[model samples]
Target: MKHNNKYERPKIVKQVDGLMNKVGRPALNKPFDKIDNVPVDELISNFGSPLFVFSERTIRNRLNDAKNTFTIRYPDTVFAWSYKTNYLDAILSIMHQEGSLAEVVSEMEYEKARRLGVPGNKIIYNGPCKTRASLERALKEGALIQMDHLDEIAEVEEIAKSMDVKPSVSLRINLDAGIYPQWNRFGFNLESGMAIHAVKRIVLGGILKLTGIHCHIGTFILDPLAYKRAVEKIIAFEKELESKFNLKLTVLNMGGGFASSNTLMNQYLPGDQAAPSFAQYADAITAPLLSVQNSYSRKLILETGRAIIDDAGYLIATVIGTKRLVSGYKSIVIDAGLNLLITALWYKLQILPAQTYKGVVEDTVVYGPLCMNIDCMRDAIPLPDLQKGDKVVIKPVGAYCVTQSWQFIKLRPAVVLIGADGSVDLIRRAETLDDIISAEILPERFKS
Candidate 1:
């Protein structure tokens, strides 16, 4: 295919005044127009427009890179896939195949991991809302339960006493790690001495055994030095407890909030340039942990979500229509909306055209098919002229969106996985009208 570098001025320019002010043109350089050797046009043809395509090769490579980077620095390391990020069975299977443990927050997610044949010992349950029944099951099945609050400690004590079994448990501690907007709501506060008190309550009860101490200071943490601070604090706490309580906390779960290559809306530079590499983060965390002695050696656990799978997924949508606003600005609507691609609200998702075009770039407002006014993807993005049927691919959207998408306004679309051998598999089918109404039981008078 021959490239088009020639540019022609657009015909839609109308002077606002006798002396019109010139508008600045934004850059429109795209990295690539195709995905995994498949053109965006052919993907929309084989599947439908507004579809999701995942690269299994990309997922494997990223996970492998993360594991190797950490294991080389810290010998005993484990990575648990954050279930809430993207918990489709197919996605979970890929993570499990790569030897990732399941780290889930809710009861539903914990059950999903179990249903997929994941062993109980391989599951790390983290959250504040695990019911008593869920706690009972987790204890019996040997799942590592990271207690979030003091009330949960009482519930676990009752369950452990009834079963006549001493279950190994961990406490989720929240402390200052030089990170802003601390996540204190999810775990016991270490600064206020609540975490130590909770541990003493459990130890005094003698029904539960303290096995580990875990902390997830914040999310989307960009500074690797922050991890060093967190690790140092956790190790200090470990040593203090060993001296005071004479107990060993074996596992130290420095939870994950690694940033992905999706440019935040507030960011000035592109994410590929701004985000830190895995090796950098590994260095910050492992450097502090390698100083531990042989007897107190703790297994480091990570639950990285977005960084592993964001760049591996793509959302393909076609141009539904185009129009010119009254202000002479160009606007194009696509089939995808906030309902499908929620990342549009936070990150500037990169959209690339399927084919080449020859024209001067203009600032275009991208809208979704929804009737609401907030269904906008990109504002004032520079692009060439687009037709009604032009297909485009939005990229690096593989995290959080899939599991958080709602069945509102429009039905959900299908998700396909592209294998390492170039095979395309439709792992999830699109939703239908019957799916919406199947669970509804209409009253006799309401039934037509």
Candidate 2:
């Protein structure tokens, strides 16, 4: 008989009633070697480790599914890509190609959309702080400015008078959607009669046209019933606007808060199981709009961001070293940190080994290379034994990671887009030392 010589680490097992021990369960040893049919090793070799990868196919498919799901029921549904979600030029270009319009929240974002060749009429300008110059520019360029407060109505009227342009605007109304922690900071409150008051003020002023009503309840909302309540309230308001002021609203903007398939830190179930599907949300939102009595045709705008782009993005990090903690638990340090993957602060992101591994499964804490103690990625996860120079893949990061990433202890890495045809293209290059200090100014007095 041949003697087996495989080495395995010794670990004490604690048995609990009605709970299967991880030691007796199958190990998560399956290798995640490829992304969109492209090998992970080849990507790291070409773009270097700690890279961001996006799948073009995944984005298109998700967007198409969302469009079809909503349009099939509403028919007048329009998708305005939320720039703040993931505003890469390539990502925006893809959205534009798919017939989506631009939804911007700041002057910089509005300018970026313009530079990308998106027409002014196609842009939906939204936010609380719209500078005087930017508001004037948006008015002149035909952007749909969604007013957030009563003061903004007067400001828009002033800008309209100066530019001699009759800008059709939208009002963002916040209401009680049966959800906790209501987002009443940005827009007028509907339940308190503030929304109706604002509408009357705008209609009576006659300087700006109130052609639309918008509402954004909250972010990452898991309950579809919240949207139903918001829509019902919006329809009631529309009825009041038409009956009292004879103002017929042509647009209904339901600002996006659809949850993405990324598990929240305190969630009881995984994201895929907890997050509501696009179909479920569509069913909840469209039912109320369809029940309205008015015969006037209205365009419904959805400003979804994370749901369409989150799962399409990925992060590949290389393991720098591994160590055993003082408590006998294992830990591994990767090249990527909180700077690159800030969403890790709220999301329990999924991490998988880039290559195959076989050994004892242990609870490991994945940490970033940053010297800060808060650079921990995964606090405790059951993972196979990982060694130095190994690679790991963190996923569903395609939404806010790239835009929110900053230069902290390490420079940001290159980002690549994998096309449907399996061709890879570099969307963003890695940061260099010169890139970081190019805008700095030094005084001659400080020079040696």
Candidate 3:
């Protein structure tokens, strides 16, 4: 396969005129009812500024998209919800209802999975560091524990020896997927024969049982071929292990890197253009493994984090003010900042107005409530003329939004789950000073 250097255009530094200005009313007339009923100002007045609003419709739609991809391909495929993506109980409940098992990294997340009622066998315990207690709990419950490093593998072996039962384990593999230049951190190095060494350690250790192999190349992967290449590499590696150790691999775990619908601004066309749909990803990852003529039959498992939840969330904010840049660009300042929705800062975000075009079209920028100098939302976005208070909707933020949010200057935003029947429930409340101070134990001398 030849690499196409054509897509590598330098970042679009210069601004283009508003789509409405270039294309006129038709562009503005694209239905805005999705944004109409839930006005940003109304939400701000009711729930306050910098509110995080999520759509149940988007969640179900994207979930179905991912599930359909695998269901259509293989008879036995399991999707473990990567809890690190967005662990909000409401969101996890949705995935649970959709038949997704939990994939957790930390003791907190493992406990969260148990609390969510995910069966012990359904959970995949992943991460480099694990406390002995967490390991004991997960192993006792019969979870699929994926080992990250050699030290962790040794710890698992020691813990397994202490247990009445042997824990089922899998070794994480790092392969040359051809897309990411940085795949060395998470899994065992495949090229360096470290993965083979780890496999031997697990097999000969006599306490931990090797059940699967796992790898995650990169995140928001736009190219389907990258996954195909990864699948082929993993299959070849799987064959090598089976031949050397005489172990029948029970499952092949491909850690998730599927891209969601949200547009990465660096992308030439929006993320939707380059973003492979769930079905495309399923085909890419499954084809290579299934293609092998006489390989051992193993259950294909997906530990998808972002693709399942990224589109389910919406960050609704009120436009506090609007400013025209000195370079003739437009900006819209909002209540939410990088603290609550950090993905916006990491990826180029798509901005949308709550209501249809009743006002004139203009360029705009969105700002959050943080006082830091680096705080920004979207720079040079094109939107309609606005007043002091107007509703704005920024989307495809379901994954990595709430999970990574920090309680900085302002309290974190309220997360509301809008149900399929239009019923809204507050899954998480906005942070308060009292809530902040609750964790503090003031010294006697400092007490007023």
Candidate 4:
């Protein structure tokens, strides 16, 4: 990777009253003293290196921030927890406790939602692929099954034919948000008139009842106008559906793409640097929807995954080694790898030395303890001096990191939830060798 030679990190000075340093970036006040008292050191010593910690306060605050934004503007709003974002039971349960319904895409997610005590009626099932059994089961359970394609529609129709009751359905619409190469695979095309055709088929098909129209333009959207435009186009189609077919739309699901605070490496500033907060997203989505006039008022449903969880999660790792390159620059390697925190490989995350920021900054690279050359955390980071055995904290990773982690060459790390009272408890135990090999059995003659 080529480093940006023109880039310069500002010299930061802390103020007693406020958080900004000379760099204007919000400096993180070291919480190690408070954190250390919680037995994190004991847990790490017992559980080993590379730990994942979640703050219950952050999760509740972020969720309330997102929920309050929409509730202030729109009368009828429902926030569905996007299960694929971070599906840890503790995380999902926290969201559920905060009144979020489940937004699932697959059978596993649907079952997970069921396990979490979310009634089937509260679950919104979306995705391109669905098995016949899955569709039948979702139908039987009265979950909101979103139609992805004609084949899925046929599958649902076949099951509905044998069942005693008809199924409730929603059609996923693909809109040209005037951005991207266009997403045509997951949903029916709105501009090409395919979506209208599908709606008519579902209305006339007799096996399924169309309850809503759903649209998801894109993911990690930086511009608020993109959502405004998408909402306008979506409402226009809702109008056409109502006028043309006399259908009363019950819900309009503008699917999740709200960008999290983790900035992409290619981005000029970090995602938290200029990325819109949860309130901004809520406003961008609901404003256009509320402006539209409808015969039957529609409930605005949001399947937000990343923005809800990203700020609440933190990955804590210990510095395992330090090295000086042939070019005489310092580098730090940690025990955590891309196998556990995939976002670190893509997002140039802001790394802070937990207890030690000695005001000395250097251009550095952070690497993970992986054999692959590609398993790097940050290529060229201007960070404070770090020593081996010192702790480092990477923030705003409460979103897709845990859900997307891979077990490539290492076991995943344990996840601990820090409560409001400052007590810590293990939510997920770190993987064990027996846990890994329990599913496998060797024949006596073929044992290695």
Candidate 5:
């Protein structure tokens, strides 16, 4: 092995934000080195590094765990795979196999679900923006469309007037759930009576049937008490709707904002230890809901994206180089970055070496290959000493990363799925220049 011992780290003494200026060997001796008993070397040899690998067994098990937790408590729970979370066809297939309905926000996603053979009724269409054509198609296909604004109601009403069938509609409500940076932009506010008024217009219009209610409090909710409080407000709103309009809700979509085992940057404890279990969330949601049962006993709907999938996904990348930072800290560059692992911005992503070595571990900063200084995967974490071409796994990336990933300085890589039978499948092929340039059209005036 070639040693990079060129620059001696400058010695400095400083302290900030409770961190002491200290340089020493890493305290931990062990490194997490495998996935599903498959050695990291085998995965890299077959799929190549800088790859996204998912465990089919993990997905199935998580979905089953969430489903069982809720259904065992309330008995009428339905899990809708949040499309924007990780909508790869194989992932959705796994979700659907575990009996998840498609919960989509836009026309493209709605159409994608339709193409995937998800029945219209099984799809919950929710978002602030829905074109008239999507509303018409959703209506004709018998989808459950949740009204986010009164204008949407009017558009759907207009479409219903021309058609012979009434559109099945629900209302997305916003309320003060005692959470910071409240999400009030998407739905009508319950405190302001906007939500109630929207529902009233739909019920009075006679052109649409108000059949469901929805409220997505926010994302990465660590406290189950926040959900408990949100559920109370939703239940109260449901009663108010029923009492005033005589409209019964057939579906209550408690929009999924469940936290996964990926630790937030601000979090002090590991996610597996700090975040509440599915059982706790189940209890918080279903306990209050079970107390009341009307003729239209609502089908409890959950659209969790991260909790069921994050821990199941892992990104394996090859270390390009290691350097000693000016502060005498170690820095390791990996082949993956914010382009493929955007969650690194707010998540303290767990990264581990592919092979084990015990001594001389140190505090390491993981960086991406991008020329930009901001292309870092982790800030400061204790990692085993690594060399060029060594592999590391950044995990709990099963949700949001792929859906929100964009190519920048480097080409995107392939995504491989490890099946329950330990069979490896290349779900997404690595992007190439041809793939990126397929849509390019040189202007006739500029073409040489």
Candidate 6:
């Protein structure tokens, strides 16, 4: 039997101790050509390279799964879409359509939510910094203000007094949830008596009504038991608050820190295998709430953002060049960079070939098209020989990349949403030179 052979240029290779030879190695390349049945090539041709593609079906399904997972365990579960995670109007609209309240961390995010038709009452206003004007507007609109410090309480009280309205607010508590690097910066400290002191001050002020309690342990939390500990601490504090002030809280906001299925840079296993499922998180959270539900029913508000949106997003980039380093290692450069995919710093995002190929898999270093050395995406990844003009899909970037992305050497790319019915919509258009300098004003002398 005769087999067809392709000619190739032979290169010298360095032999490393205990390393397997590349010969006879099975090709690990698999084509990821389409997103929701929409061809990747078609998308890049219609839009451009380095495009952001989101699956509307994935977003809805993930949100629905989260809602169902918690609602079945506890009927009072409420989901608030964390705006800081990915505040793209289209994403927010989808979240709102799926019945998620807006959870904002800043005045800008709060305004964005309001502009999207989410009433002030439906907005969960959080964060360490809240301006006077925003606070006033939120109070007037009956927003759920989560007070971060005693100063915010004073500010809110003053505003409430001026408006002649007693706004029901929630206190953000920061506690030692048996996790490393405790997040005690944003909220009142629980162990240091700061939380109790803040509560006392709120009650003593008598200007604002304290109706709820909120806490966010940390982001990308892997341990379910950590949440269990947080819930236990919150429940205990709630009891103390109720007993001391004869005030029963109505809402317990276990803030968003849910881990998405994107592998952390330091993780040994992939995110999907290591991270807890929605069911596990629901059980850990609802178990404690269910135990005390008989005494007083409380609305459980979950401001989960990453877990629901991360896996739905994909970044389609084009390979521009390939090279061999001094150490005889292969390197591939793509069009997308740290400017467009900021989350690449924290996540070891999976990169897949857009077309099927038969080639030897090598440990290749993936670099972004940037002059800076820090623009490298993957330090070392096992990938087949990727040539110029080849398309690659980098994924699970639906959470923070867009929200945190900024324009640097290159303008930002366009983002499109592939709907459940295979319809494509351009949610955000690619940035142009005018878009970058539109707000800039040249000096009179310079203009002349």
lDDT of 1 at 149: 84
Top of the candidates by lDDT = 2
Clashing pairs in 5: none
List per-prediction Cα lDDT, in the order shown. Answer: 0.86, 0.91, 0.78, 0.81, 0.85, 0.90
* Candidate 5, lDDT over the whole model: 0.85
Q: Whose lDDT is higher: candidate 3's or candidate 5's?
A: 5
TM-scores for the candidates:
0.93, 0.94, 0.90, 0.90, 0.93, 0.94
For model 1 the TM-score comes to 0.93
Per-residue lDDT of 157 in model 5 = 89
Taking every candidate in turn, the Cα RMSD to the unseen true structure, in Å, is: 6.6, 4.7, 8.5, 6.2, 4.6, 5.3
Which regions of candidate 4 fall more than 4 Å away from where they truly are? Answer: 1-43, 294-296, 357-359
Task: Give candidate 1 regions above 4 Å deviation.
Answer: 1-32
Tens digits of lDDT, candidate 2, 121-239: 99999999999899988998999999999888999999898878778999999999998898989889998989989988998888998899899899999999899988988888888
Between the candidate structures 2 and 6, which one is better when assessed by lDDT? 2
Q: What's the residue-level lDDT of 172 in candidate 1?
A: 93
lDDT of 6 by residue, 315-391 (tens): 99999999998667899999998998888888888888899876566778999999999998998877778999999
Question: Residue-pair clashes per candidate, as listed?
Answer: 0, 0, 6, 2, 0, 0
Candidate 4 residue pairs in clash (backbone atoms < 3 Å): 263-271, 309-398
User: Which of 3 and 5 is the better model by TM-score?
Assistant: 5
Report the C-alpha displacement of residue 162, candidate 2, in angstroms. Answer: 1.0
Candidate 2: where are CA atoms >4 Å away?
Answer: 1-29
